[model samples]
Target: MSEQESQFLLILFGGIFFAFLMSLFVVAMVILHRQRQVKNRQKLEQIKSEYEKTLLNVENEIHQETLAQIGRELHDNIGQLLSLTKLSLNSAKPEKQQQAKEYVNQVIKEVRALSKTLNLDWVESLSLDEFINQQLHRIQATGFCETSLQSDHSFAELKKEEKLVLIRVIQECLNNAIKHADPSRIDIRIHQNGKVRILQIADDGRGFDTSQKSSGSGMYNLGKRMETIGGKFQLSSIVGKGTVVNLELPFSV
Candidate 1:
């Protein structure tokens, strides 16, 4: 072969080899990007699954609590009313019969009100402020402790799941206070702060130390529930002074 021809052939082969290497590198990069995308998608799916499970659990707990309340009302309130009604009816006086008829009417009204609470539809329709006010009133009615609610009337526009979770958290806090704290007064405040909605539940009860680890996982679970809904739960307590639970929720501007 001639020297010039040999030189040209060598350069041609070298160029071909370089092109092959570049093609391989591009293929490798594409594969890596696809793998990363798949991983991220899987992680997102896992997070969504966990959030859904938490939401279902919160709903069930609230339902059970409602059922319990209904049972108590039926047994304690309605049952007594019925007994009084029977006694009044048996009396010979015409006025006593009239009073018995009134008792029957009251029982009907109480029943209809209780029936309204039997379904989960209220979770979607009830505003956070309204629910908090209702809870406070219920406690006050019990005469166990004085209760009050203060709100600017501005409220969070929350999804049904978010509202449900938030309601359960508040119920748990109130139950804890009444069951353990022996507080004379319980107060709840709801308002907006910039892009955040805030709820503060404060009680003049026997507070416990937040530093000490609790035997039950109630506090930790409450915190996790708030986190799932993109909110924060903070609790502060003193030995004898009082306890306060603060919840902050962020909203889009």
Candidate 2:
């Protein structure tokens, strides 16, 4: 072969080699971009989880603070005023007006009785099963309606904090029942599967349509709290039959 012909062939081979190198670099850049996208998604998920935990903690602190303020008002102010009112009524003795004073005293007495029962902290340490039963006993004790509690077996070893949350959820449902439906009976049941604890609270009260459920703050809070712990919350209600609240928590050792 001629010397010039050999030089041309060498330049052609070099160009082809350079093109392959550029193609390899482009492929590498594409791969790195994809990996980075995946990493960003994972980080976003972590951030979301952290934000939810922060929200939950903030809500818990607020609830505690509010309850403490309520306790202070009941014990420090209302209690003392009621006592003073009762003392004056007793000091004044008139047979004709005595009955009216007695009625006033009675109202104060009833209000005082209610002050001692407002904040319930015992639920903070109760187990899931125990908490459910406690709520039933409470509602039943009122004598306004009967409450029945049943459990399939032990709960899924739920954390004490979560137990309290679920207990609060049950209590809220009961309160709504009393306030709205005036149910004759309320039934609460618990069940556990391999990795989920199920709580069902049903009341034979005049149920309202749950179609606009997202508007109720109490129910929305219940759902949010349960979801923060990898749990599920459901509500079903019929205008005449009853309302049913279902909560499911994933079992974590």
Candidate 3:
């Protein structure tokens, strides 16, 4: 080849190599940028998890405080009124006794209605079975669906916070089952084996494609609530088999 031609070819090869190095450098920078973004997202998730833990703690304290206040009110005002009405009835004359008895009876009825204050502090004194039973009763009172809870005696030994989360999670499960599944029968089962607590809610209804429906806030919240307490949440459903929400909590309160 001629000297000038050889020189031109060398320069062309050098330019191509430089362009190749530039492209490699650009690709490396892009990859580094993506890694940084992923790291930031992980850090944000950690912060969010910590925040939710603190928030749940605060809410629990508030709920306990409110329950105490309500219990005091029921014992003080309602209890005193019922006592005073009973004493007044005891002193009334025979001619006036029937009228007095009716008034006292009405007052006693009001006091009993007010006594549902047990709901306010239910978690403090009741086992998980009782807590969930009361909630299921409330749901049944709506007459919208048939709800049942089956639990082991060991369920009451669960940590109060864990029990609270499970209770709320079950409610959300039932809500979804009713709203999305259009279920006629909703069943919740909870049992403890040693330190592990397993909970499941299932329904017989039109099932859904869970792969396409994983972004629901109710499902996300239940999962997050379980994670906060070191529990695992899982969901599975087939187009015709119906949905099952499963949870396992291994630690004690």
Candidate 4:
């Protein structure tokens, strides 16, 4: 072969080798990018699984707490009323028979109302607005604070799981306000705009600074619980002005 031809062939071979190397590099980069994406997606799924597990545990705890509260009310409040009614009946004279009859009727009514609360499955049956209003009634019954609920729209279409999570979340919010905030008044408002449903719980209590670090798991759990349901939780508080919690959830989801 001629020397010039030999040099030209060498350059051509070198160019082909460089092109192959460039192609290999591009393929490797694409593979690596896809792997990273898969890893990220797996991580998110794992996190979601863990969050859901935690939520289940939290929900169970709340259920137990609620049962305990009911037991107390049954024993301390309803039980006493029944005892009084029984005595009133036993002591009835002809002159007081009408009064005793009225007292017995009242007791029957109270028992019937309390019986309705004993059924936990009512959570599945009642509308979200009714459930919340019941909670507000319980708070008022306790005389811990004055409570009110206002809904611009009714939420009758929440899924079973959505209702469960929301029920727990609202219970936690009210419990925190009553236990920690020492609020005199608590108000819950529910409304909808377009495709979004908004729930706000506001308290007139001693609030804390959100920027400051606090060792409270309630707030952390609240945020995590919202995330699990693909919702957003926001809190705003001023030292003495009180605190308000804002939750936004998609109506369809």
Candidate 5:
């Protein structure tokens, strides 16, 4: 072969080799980008799992606290009242016997109502709407506030975990309204549109400014909890008017 031909062949092969190296480099970069995405997605899933577990623990604590409070009320207040009623009925004269019987009947009625509150199994057995209504009834029974619930659809489609998160969110909202808002009336409404479920809680209480940053973590945590469940939380408040909380959740069949 001639010197020029040899030189041309060498140059052409060099160019081809360089092109191959560039192509390999591009492939390596693409692979690295994909790997990074996988790692990030895995990290996000791990964080979400931890959050859900923590939230479940918090809910269990709340349940225990409620049970303890009920236990104390049963032991100290209701138990004593019932005992007194029984004693009065047993030792009453004929003229006072009728009044004593009426009083005992009233006590019996109160005990039966309180018994409903003591049933923790309702958490698993009842639908979300039923559970929410029960909580509202408990609030009204305390004579602290007038509470009402309206639902356009049932929450039987929700999974157990979804229901737990929702119940916690509802309880948190209720606690905030009762402890801070000092509302006379609280209303909860639930409805569904397509695959989205909506819950709105409104209180005719002395509301605060939503624009102002507060030192409380209740609102922040509530939003985070909803996000963990792939839901959205919104709050609106007007000073001296009222507050409304809207939660939207996506349902899967």
Candidate 6:
């Protein structure tokens, strides 16, 4: 070939080689992007699966607790009422028979209430505020401590699973206070600020140190449960002052 022809051929080959390299780069970039997408999708699926499993476990725990509570009520409360009712009926006096009739009616009411608890639907129907009030009432009924609830009554909507977890956690906190704190008063406050909803359970009990590692897994498990529902658990305490547990749930409206 002539010199100019050789130079032209060299230029053409260089241009083709450059274009081939560019095509290979584009292909590699596309493959890399696709692989990343697949990985992200798998990670999301795993997270979703774990969330669902946690929800199921929470539900089961609540049901089991409710059943136990029902058993106690039946044995402690209703059984006594029935025994009194039989005695009144046997007396044969008009007033005694009337008292027995009233006892029968009260027993019916109590039985109906217990039956409702057997179904888990009540968990779905109870609002967070209502649940707090009910729990406080139970504590107060025991005369172990004074209980109060301060709420705006405006609560953010929460999933049933989230509410169940909160209920269980609060129950545990109350139980701990009753068992160890020896507090004269237990207070619960619920409030909503924009997208954030908070529930604070405070007790004027003998508080413990939060800095030291807890020997029990209760606190750790409570934190993990809150994290699963995109909420936060914070407990603050002082030796003589009191202990306060703050549970925060942030959601978009």
* lDDT per residue as tens, model 3, 1-253: 9999999999999999999999999999999999999999999999888857755764565466446646765687667766766766777577456656766777677666556553546556667677667656766776867889887765556666666676666666766777888777778898777878788888877888877856548677667778877888998888867888888888564
1-253 per-residue lDDT for model 1 (tens digits): 9999999999999899999999999999999999999999999999999999999999899989999999999999999999999999999999999999999999999999889889889887788888998889989998999999999865547888888989999999999999999999999988889878889999999998888989999999999999998999999999998899998888844
C-alpha lDDT values of all predictions: 0.92, 0.73, 0.73, 0.83, 0.83, 0.87
**Candidate 4 residue-wise lDDT, 1-253, digit = tens:** 9999999999999999999999999999999999999999999999978977966776686678667877887798778767766776677476456666776787688677667766467677788899889889988988899999989864678876677778888888888898889999999999987888899999999998899988868788878888777788899999999999988898774
What is candidate 5's lDDT per residue for 78-146, written digit by digit as tens? 787777767677874874577667767876886776676564555577788888887899899889999
Look at candidate 1 and tell me the lDDT of residue 141.
95
Residue pairs whose backbone atoms clash in candidate 6:
none
- Candidate 6 CA-lDDT value: 0.87
Kindly list the per-residue Cα lDDT of model 6 for residues 1-253, writing each as its tens digit: 9999999999999999999999999999999999999999999999999888877887787888899889989998999999999999999799999999999999999999999998779878888788778878878997888999898754547777777778888878888888888999999888888878888889999999888998899889889888888889999999978899998888734
Which run of 10 residues does model 2 get worst, by summed lDDT? 117-126
Runs in model 4 deviating more than 4 A are 3-8, 81-120, 193-195, 208-212
Give the 10-residue window scoring lowest on summed lDDT in candidate 3. 114-123
Q: Per-residue alpha-carbon lDDT of model 2 for 1-253, expressed as tens digits? A: 9999999999999999999999999999999999999999999999798756745664475366447646765686567666666666666567535665665666577666555445444444446667567657867876989988888855647665566566556666777888988999998888777777788889888888777645558777778777766778999999899999888887776
Number of the predicted model whose lDDT against the real structure is largest: 1
Candidate closest to the true structure, highest TM-score: 1
Backbone clash pairs for candidate 2 read: none
- Candidate 2 residue 188 Cα shift, in angstroms, is 0.8
* Candidate 5 ranges with C-alpha deviation above 4 Å: 19-23, 30-34, 76-78, 85-121
Judged by lDDT against the true structure, how good is candidate 2?
Answer: 0.73
